[model samples]
Target: MKKLLIPFKISLLTVLFCVCLTNAGQRRLGTSAANGLVIQQIILKGKVLSAVNNEPLAGATVRTEIASIKTDQKGNFTVITKKNKGTFTVTYLGYQTKEIQHDISTSQYYTIKLDPQQNTLDETVVIAYGQTTKRFNTGSVGRVTAAEISRQSVANPIAALQGRISGVEITQQSGRTGANFNVLIRGRSSIANGNEPLYLIDGVPWLSAGISKASSVGSQSPFNSINPSDIESVEVLKDADATAIFGSRGANGVILISTKKGKQGKTEVGLNAYTGISQVGHTMPLMNTQEYIEMRAQAFVNDKISPTSVNAPDLTLYDQQRYTNWKKNLIGNTAHLSDLQLNLSGGSDKTQFRISGAYRMEENVYPGDEADKRASAQLNLDHRSENEKFRISFTSSFSDYKNNILPTDLTEGIYTAPNLLPYEDNGSLSWSENGSAVYNNPLAATLRSYRTKTQNLVSNLNANYSITKHIAIRLNAGYTTIATDEANVYPLSSFIPNNSRISGESTFANSDFNSWIVEPQLTYNRSFGDHKLEMLLGSSWQEEKSSGRVIFAVRLQTKLDTLG
Candidate 1:
C-alpha cells in the first residue's frame, strides 16, 4: 500500500510541473489564459487620400470583391478582414484603383492614395451636409463649386444652386430688395409646414429667420444674413439618410455651406470681382395710345357718361400722347450689378484664422427700383494645444442690407392694379380736377411704399478635448441677432381719398436668439489578428431661445426714407 501511494503522488507532481511550463510558454507568446488575440480576424485602420493633393478624401470605397466596407466621415477607414490570404481594393470615382495584399499579422492597414483616372466618369461627389461614396449612395446629391457661382455673378447663394441641381427648384418672391430667394430641395412635401431645407454653415446650424408664414409683409422677418462670397462649397443634402441627423428640422433635407477656413500654411489673399447687366425678360401687354382712347370711350359708354361730361375736353390728345405711354415711361432699361470680395486665410498648428469681406450692388429686373448695397464681414480663429488633445475655435460674422424702393413698387403696382390707367393730357400725368375713384392713380402708392434696412450679427465658439486615444468631449455655444427697420408710405390713392393723405407707415422689429450644444462621447477599440471591434457611446443636448419686438409709426410727411 505504501508503494502504490508513492507512485500516485509522483504522478500528481509531474502534472503540476507540466502545467506551469505550458503557462510560461504561453506568456512568451503574449497571450492571457483566455487567448483573446488568437482569433482568425484583425482590424485595419488607415486613411484614403488624394493622390494629387495628399488631402484626405472622404467617401473612397474599400473592399474585397467578396467583402466590403466604407471610410468614415473623416476619410479614415477601419475594417475587419479574414486572416486568410487575399487582396483588398481601394477605388474611388475619378481615381485609379489601388490593390494591395492583405496579411493580418505582418501587414499594416493601407494608407491608400488613388491617382486620377480621368478617363472614366467614376467620381466621388462630396456633399456639403453629409458625405456618400458614389458606389453606395442611393439618393441624389447636387454638387456646386464656388467657382460656378462666381462665374454667373450670382448675388444670392440660392440663385447659384439653381440650374446646377436636377431636382431643386427656386422661386423669387417679389424681386424686393433684401429678397433672398427660397429653395425646394426635391419638391414641396407639405402644404402648410415650411419645407425649406435646414441650412448648416460650417458645421453649426444657421437657423432660419424664424418668421413663420403667418407673418405678413409689414411684419416679414429678414432673410438669413450670411454672405455667399465666403463660401467654399455648397452641398444640398437630398435623401433621408443625409438629413436624419437633424430629425424634425431635416424633413426637407438640408443645405450645407462650408465656409473658407485657414489651412496649415502661410497667409494667402484672394480677390474676386464681377459685373453684369439684367434686362426685363417680359413686359405686360398694355394699351397703346389708340387702345387707351378706345378703352376710355368704352368706359364712358359703360358708365353712361357723355363725352362732354369728361373734365378734359381734348380726350383725343390725352389718348394720342399721354396715358398710353405711362407703362413704358414708368419702367426703365436693363439693370446692372457689381460684386467685389476679398479673403485672407492662414495659420500654424497652434493657431489659424480666416477673414473675409464682400460688397454687392444690383438693379433687379423690375424697373424704377434698385438694390443699393449688401455687405458682409466674417472672421474665424482656431487654437490647439501642443499635444492636440484640446482645441478651441471662435467664429463671428456681420451683415448689412439696404433695399431701395423703386423696383419693388413697380412690381406691386402692376400686379395689384393691372386695370388702373393713367389719364394723359398734353404729355403729362393728368389728375382729375375732382378726384374720381375710377381714375385713381397708382404712382402715388408706388412712391410712398416702404424701404427696408437690416443689420445682423452672429458669433459662436467651439471647443473639443481628447481624454485618451479613444475618448473625447466637445462643447459649443452661439448667438445670433437681427435688427430691421422699414418705412412705408401710402398716399391718398392707396387709402380712402380722405384717409391720411400724407399716408405713410414705418415699422421696426428686432429678433435675438441664443443656443448651446454640448456632447460627451466615449470610444473603445480593440484588435484581433484580422478583426477590429469598436464601440462608441455618446449623448448630445441643445437648447435655443428667441425673442422679438416690433413697433409701428404712422403719418410720415415725406416720401423719403427718413421718418417724420
Candidate 2:
C-alpha cells in the first residue's frame, strides 16, 4: 500500500508541473501578438480631388472600420487605423463613393480622385412651394440647368426651353423679334381659358399681359421682359403630383424659374454682350412683269374674256417693263440684334447680395421703324442669423420695354403685282388708278406709326424662423405691377382718296395689372431609426386687380389731333 501511494503522489506532481509550463508558454505568445498589433497600427494621409476638373474637394469623408475623418478645405485628410491592411471608403456629395484596400504600413500619403456619379437619382430638384431630391419626387418634372441655357442665345427665355423638354410644344407665332409664342404643355386642355402654362419667377407668379394668340396688329409676350442670362434654372412640372401644389393655377401646367443668386464666396462681376444679324430664311418667288402679263392673259382666257375688251381698263399698267421684288423692298433682307448684361454678386457668412442691369435691342425684319428695345434691373438680397435659425430674403426687378411695330400684313406685299410701282415719277405714292383695284402702297403701310410700351415691377420678400430642429415657419409676400400703353396713327397720305371722310385715324390703349400675395407655412420634419417623416401646413391669400381704357378718334380736321 505504501508503494502505490508514493507513485500516485509523484504522478500528480508531474501533471501539475506540465500544466504550469503550458500556461507560461501561452502567456508569452499572447504578449508577442499584442506587440505585433501595435506595430501594424499606422496613420494614413491622402488628398481628394474631382476626377472631371481635378478640383480639390473639401468636406470629403474618409472612414475605416475603427476610425473616421474628414478632409480639410484644402482637400487633405488623415486617418489612424490598427491594421496594416484594411478597406477605407471615401465619400462626397454628387460623387460616387470609393473603397480602397491599402497597406497603410507601406505608404504614408495617397492622392485619391473621385468620379462624379452619372445617375441623377441623388440630384436635388426644385418643386412647387419647396425643394426635394429626385429620388423623393413622385411626379414627372423636367429641369433645365443654367449651363444648358447659357449654351443658346435666344431672344426670349422660353425659346431656350424649346426641344429640350418633353411634353412641351413651343411655337413662335411670327418671325418678328420679341413676338409672343404659344407654349403648350401636354397639349391644349382648355377651350375657353388660355392654354398657357403658369409662369412663376422666383416663387412669384408672373402676370402675363396680352393674349397668347397673335393678332392682326402684333403679338406681345411678357416672357420677353425677363433676361435669359439672369436665369439660373428652370423647372417644368407636368404631372399631378408636381403641379397639384399650385392648385387651380396648375390646371394646365407650371413653370418655375429661378434667377441667379449670390454665392457664399468672393465677389464676382460678370459682363456678357452679344451682337448678331438675322436674315429672312427663305424668299417667296413672285411673278415678275413678264410672268404677270402671261398669268393675266391666261386668266382672261380661262374666264372666256377677250384681252382687247375695254372691260379690263388700264391694261397698260401691266404693260410696264420694270420689275420689283416686293419682299426685298418691304421686308428687309436682314435684322440686327444686340444684348448687353452686367452683374455683380458676392456674400459673407451672414449676408449675400446680387444686382444686375441689362439692355437689349432687336431690329425687326421690316425696313421702316420696326424694332424692340428693353431695359431691366434686378436686385436680390439674403440674410441669415448667426445661429442659422432665422433667415430673410428680398428680390426686386424692374423692366421697361418699347416696341415699334409694323401695322400691315407682311404677306400682302409679297403677292402684289411686280409691275405696280410704289412711287410715281413725281416722288408721290402711286394710288390705285380710276379703273383699277384699290391697292395701298406697301411702303406707306410700313411707314405708319404704331408703338407699344410696357413697364413691369416684381418684388418678393420672404422670412423663415426655426423653432427647433424639427419645426419651422416661413412667410412669403409678393407684389407685381404691370402697365402697358399702345398707340397707332395713320396719316392723311395713307388714305386712298384725297377727299376721304376720314382724313386720319388714331387709337390709344392703356392697361394696368396689379397683384399681391401672402403665404404662411409651418413645416415639421423628423427622423427615427432609418425612417423620415415630413409634414407641411400652409395657406395663401392673394388679390389681383386690372383696369384699362382705350380711346379712338377719326380726325376730320388735322387741328383736331391737337385737342387730345
Candidate 3:
C-alpha cells in the first residue's frame, strides 16, 4: 500500500504541474492550443428575413434540435451542432415560424424567412360546448393557440392566458410564497360569491373554479398551481351567446383548455427543460438600527415621555441587533427553478397515443425555506376509422406538489417597536435571556416553517361519431380529483413567552375535490366556395365536491415543543 501511495502521489503532482504550465502557456498565448489538437471551434452563419416584406428580420431566432441562436444586425446567427444533419427551425414573434431540413456540413449558411399570419375570412372558434365558425357565430369568443402558450413563463395555466389578449385581468395578492392569484375575465359580472371564469378541458366542463386561493386572513384560490406546460391551447367564451350553455357559472367568462394529443406519425420523443434563477427585484425601504433607535428616541422626547422608560433588556438589545438590516434578512435575494419534461407520441392511421411526464423544482430566495417540487404524468389515446368520420379519444393526468416555507411578515416584526430594545450599555443594548419579550427570530422562523403536499388525478374521455360527410355528433365525459394534505407547525417562540409560549399549533389540513362532466353535441358543416357554415349545440352536467380538516396541538411546554 505504501509503495502504491508513493507512486500515486508523485503521478498526481506531475499532472498538476503539467496542468499549471499548460494553463500558463494558454494565458500567455491568449489564443493558442497547447498541443496540435484544435479544442474550441465555432461556425456561425445564417440569414433570417421576413417572408412578407422580403427584408432582413433582425433578432429572429434560429434553433436546431438541441441548440439556439438569435439573429444579429444582419439577421444571421450561428449555432454549433454535431454532424450538421438536422432540421433548423426559425421563428419571429408575431410571425409564422418556418422549419427546414438540410445537411449542415454542405450548407453552413441559410436564408430563412418567417411569414406573417394571414387571417382567413372564416375562422373557427370554440364556444361554450362546441366549435363554430367565427364569421357566422353571433356569440363572443376568444382563442389562444399552442404557439401563444409557449411564449411566457407562466406559473399556472390561467397566467398563460392573462394579458395576452384583451379583457382579461390577473392580480397577485402579495409576493409571499404560495400567494393568492386572482383572475377575472371580462370584468366582474357578479355581486356575491366569486366572479372567476368557468374552465373546460377538451369539451368537458372542469371544476377548477371551486378551487380556493391561499390566504393568510381568509380563503383564497390555488389556481396558479396548475402547470402551464400541460396545456396545448385555450379558448375563452365571453358573451352571453357563448356562455349560455353554462348558465350556472356563465356570469363569468369560460376558459377551455386542451391538452396535447397524439397525431398520426411514427413514435417520437420530445423533451423540454429550462433552469433559471429569480430574486426579489424591489423592496420597500425601512429604518435601520441607528435610524430606528434615533427616531424612537426623538419620538419619546417629543411625546414628553422619559426615553429611559423604554429600557426593556431583551426588547432593546434584540431591536438594536435585528434593526441593523431587517430587510436583508426578510427578503430572499435569489431563488432557483428547474423544470424537465418528456413526451412520447406516435400513431398510425387508425390509432394514436401520447404519454408525457414532467418534474419541477423551485427554491425560494428566502433562507431556511424548503424548495417546492411538483411531478406530473399525462397520457392521451385516440382512435379513428379509415373513413375518418368516426373517432374516439381519452386523456388522463396525475400530479403532486410539495412546498415548505415561512411567512415574511414575521421576519419584519423582530425590529418592530413591539420588540424594540430600549436599554443600552454604552452604545449597544444589553442582550436578554429566557425572560426576553416574545419575538420570532426571522431566520429561525423561516427555517422552522411548515410543509404541504398535494396530489391530483384526472381522466377525460370523448368520442366523435360523424353522422354524415360534413355533419357529426360528439360525446365527451371527464373526471378530475385532487387530494391535498397541508400541515403547519407554529413554534412557541413565535408567540409571547409564557403559557402562550407553551401553546403550540400543529395542524394537518386535507381536502378532496372531484368533478365529472359529460357533453353531447351535434354539428353541421358546409362550404360554398369561400363561404362556410358550421353549427354546434351541446349540453353537459358538472359536479364538484370538496372537504378539509385541520388538527393542531394547542398545548406547548416550550418554544421547541412544535419542533416535533
Give the lowest summed-lDDT range of ten residues in model 3: 211-220
Give lDDT for model 2.
Answer: 0.81
Give the local distance difference test score of model 3.
0.68
Candidate 2, 459-534: lDDT as tens digits = 8899999999999999989998888888877777767765435477877888888889999999999999999998
TM-score of 2: 0.77
Local lDDT at 236 for model 2: 92
Q: Per-residue CA lDDT of candidate 1, range 358-396, in tens?
A: 898877544456455788999999999999999998888
lDDT at 364 for candidate 2? 74
**Candidate 1 local lDDT, residue 267:** 90
Which ranges in model 2 have alpha carbons more than 4 Å from their true place? 1-108, 111-119, 209-216, 307-316, 433-437, 556-564
lDDT of 3 at 556: 36
Residue 425's lDDT within candidate 2 is: 76
Candidate that would win on TM-score? 2
Q: Please provide, for model 3 over 227-323, each residue's C-alpha lDDT reduced to its tens digit, 9 standing for 90 to 100.
A: 6777877877778854566676666888888788898899999999999988767666666666666777777678886643235343234445553
Off by over 4 Å in 3: 1-124, 132-138, 209-225, 308-323, 407-444, 526-537, 556-564
Whichever of 2 and 3 has more lDDT, that candidate is 2
lDDT values for all models? 0.65, 0.81, 0.68
